[model samples]
Target: MRKIVTVADDADLAHLVDLIDMLPGPDTRSFWGEGSNSIGSKVGHRLREILSGRGDSSDVDYLAIYVLKYLGRGNRHIPEDRITANLRGASGLPAAGHAWVEDATRTAFTLVTRYSLPVWNGAHRTRGSAWLQG
Candidate 1:
């Protein structure tokens, strides 16, 4: 007869939940929960509930990293070198006085909101090279 064993420890999960609890609420000055009604916040809140075993795991893996980083895990998906290069490129744009500053702000916002989150979340799991090409 053969015995089957399962690695049933959920210590990492529980620790993750505890870390989530320590995160500041949306009203805090440093809160990164996004807008009250934004999809990001909804996903984040739902992830917390799911990790705590209070909700279902419908989209757990997809949204896990986004909220997990707030718990001090940092982003393991996106390489630090890529992030630094992107920021450096953006910062190097020529400053045509105040208009250039405005353009740079918009560019930074677009990159952070669109490229950074998607890449970090593994949305381009097979096309990581594509993100680097941008």
Candidate 2:
């Protein structure tokens, strides 16, 4: 089954690379494109590989994919609580420190709350919120 459920533009994909890289964990081991030596490119390549189910994945991969799905769905701000809940329920995510779920959540929270670049707070449309207008 396809793990990636959303489509993100190039800018969004770059932002996601930043988000995933800021998380403290094992580095991405996949080889990227020729002459693409930047860390962001490697991470982005790894993410695509995971999404396509063509490479080995870890708990961190699952966490990143879930966050990507949330972002691509037009969520301006990602709730740490919700991400935590989803990570806990995700299959194959080991309940251990090495899983890196906590680290990913912390990084994502910091990015959205402190920097406020990738995730901004505004009157953005959310799922099932259209009822409020009716």
Best model number under lDDT? 2
Alpha-carbon runs more than 4 Å astray in model 1: 1-9, 33-43, 48-54, 68-134
lDDT of each: 0.39, 0.41
Model number with the top TM-score: 1
lDDT of 2 by residue, 12-49 (tens): 33455554543433343221123465433544565766
Worst ten in a row by lDDT for model 1 = 2-11
> Clashing residue pairs, candidate 2?
none
Candidate 2: deviation at residue 16, Å? Answer: 14
